[model samples]
Target: MPGPPTIFVARQPIFDRRAAVHGYELLFRGSAENRFTGGDVESASAINIEQSTAAFGLDALVGERLAFVNLSRGALLQEFYRMLPSERTVIELLESVHGDAEVLEACRELKRRGYRLALDDFTDAPHSQPLLAYADIVKVDLRQTPEALTPGFTSRLRGKRLSLVAEKVETPQEHRRAMAAGYDLFQGYYFCQPEMIETRDLAPSQLSQMRFLAEVSRSEVSFEQLEELFRRDVAMTLRLLRYLNSAAFGWRHEIRSVGHALMLMGVRPLRKWAMMMGFLRLAGDKPHELAITALTRARFAEQLGPPAGLEHHDSELFLTGILSTAEAMLGRSLRDVLTALAVPDMVRTALLDGGSRLGAVLRIVMAYERGDWPTVESVRTECAVDERALTDAYVSSLQWAETSAAA
Candidate 1:
């Protein structure tokens, strides 16, 4: 059966002056097929965000930190802020929302209800002045405005009590400029970029775990070998037992042995679960979205395999999708990471080169992820898959990722 609608929720962290994470700006989108319909972008985005938050809960996306959500004029008029927790949600008024009487009245009402409000993509204009009365924070787009004019614009707001947020601060120089201009909050890719580390050697424990993962990924994995490997790692053994005993598995009896656990889960699911754990451990201090993306890709590729005429090799396709992001997660090339894990030749070749069937599935998954529909369509046609199957795979992958992440 088809699963839930495909919803993508990404959080961009907002940092205070001391470089502490103060909150996150929650970005959300609906399924790739329904994303762009030439409608009002802000309203559509607002609806998607509202639906996603309802389905997944706000804490799943932003943890305990404040969530800044963009509200279109329509959403503001609907009093959407009333539905969210006032203390934890910051209603960001989109730049497209003119500071007219209705919007201002709505903003005033929201403030009266104890909800904090922010002005998104703030620019010094005559029309924006009225919003200042209700705005607790104002975000200025560094990329859209000239550096020479930023100081002048920000200085004019010095008398106001609102905190200034500098958006799109993409470089060290821009960060410094924002700091100099007395901006209290910062957001952008500058903070999330992966820091390249020269040493690529896995820790001794991680090496052992990878070896076990490689064994499980084999076409013919032995139960005895998995039992022996689990026996060596006390934490893994306990985790497996706990997972087996959990309500999700609905085991009637307590799992007392590693072999028993392996028998219950079977080699296929065990391999996928272990690989996910290993990759997440290797991710270290990387952003949470990295794990989400990897798992989503893995599931998407696996589901797409049957439709793409590679049903017999779905596991290999899944591995290819997961390993495609290894370079970003491990700060090393895909070849090096795969070699370290001793992945299958087909999976390695698919990731390193772009000719294999698994490679084609990976390409389609990636293009679909980026909403590059034309490229996705071309690859889908080449693989002889229809749009419905592809959309179902994508949506199901998203649902699996969300559920797995919560687990």
Candidate 2:
């Protein structure tokens, strides 16, 4: 069967004074591979937001936590903000939104309907003051606003009964400054940076599992080839048999040998299973999210393969996704990890440089994950996949990851 279409959504956490997660600002990219054109921003934002909410549902995107969604001036005027639950939804108006009569009326209506409003990238300009009357929160871009101006900015708004949100808080010092400046909330990458850890040599078992994964990823494999590798580790042998006989598979007869399991589970399923198992075994003390990310990327790439004219080489695409994060997950450079795993030149080129079709798709996946909607749109146009296909693939990948993590 063909894989799912690609759709991408990313959430940036918002923190309160105590440094606890208060809510998330959900960012949407319409297509997994496409960039937004210089067309109507309101229409594009609305389309992407609607597509994402339809695919994942609002609860799946933000869980029980509150969610902040950006509303273009057009969306606000049209009352699209009313679609979401008011108690947990914060309707964010862009700074570019003019405080015209229509917009101000929309803001008043939204507040009257019990929807909290935020002004994104707030600047204390004369144009923004009119909207401030309805804004419950104001986000100041620390990167763009000078430190000297921040105190006066907050001081001026002190009587407005609005919460101050310090956006683009990129450092510990900036976080402290924002707090001192009377900001009530914070948002940025200061707290999400990965800790650098010393790289270590792989254990014998891990090395074996790596080799086993490499073998599974190959184009052709025989029962003897799989059985020989399975016999080297008793645990792997049991895992294979158990998976094949599990209720999910529902085979008519019980499997008795590794060969039987291999025959029952086709090459594609076997390869995915082996790859997932290998990653689980190798991810020692690593964050569980890394595994989830790798698996999701793998499924996403595989789903994109056929549409990109790589129908016969989906396994390679899957491996490309899985190995893309090896550096971060293993605390080693990608070049070194790929060299050790003996990945093909095509996969290597895709990872090192965006030179091939697979490389283009991989780039799209990475950009989408980071919420880089423009890059995603450009890459999607370059790769020639439609928005619906890409969005479906991404949503399917998320569903797959959720199921795999639970399993």
Q: TM-scores of all models?
A: 0.46, 0.46
Q: What shift in Å separates residue 182 of candidate 2 from its native position after superposition?
A: 0.8
Q: Which lDDT tens digits does candidate 1 get at residues 43-136?
A: 4544444333433456555667888887777557645444456777888988888899988888888899889999999887779888998899
Cα lDDT of all candidates, in order? Answer: 0.70, 0.70
Per-candidate clashes, comma-separated: 0, 18
Model 2, runs deviating above 4 Å: 31-39, 147-149, 193-407
Q: What's the true lDDT of residue 290 in model 1?
A: 67
lDDT of 2 at 354: 73
Query: What clash pairs does model 1 have?
Result: none
RMSD (CA, Å), each prediction: 16.2, 17.8
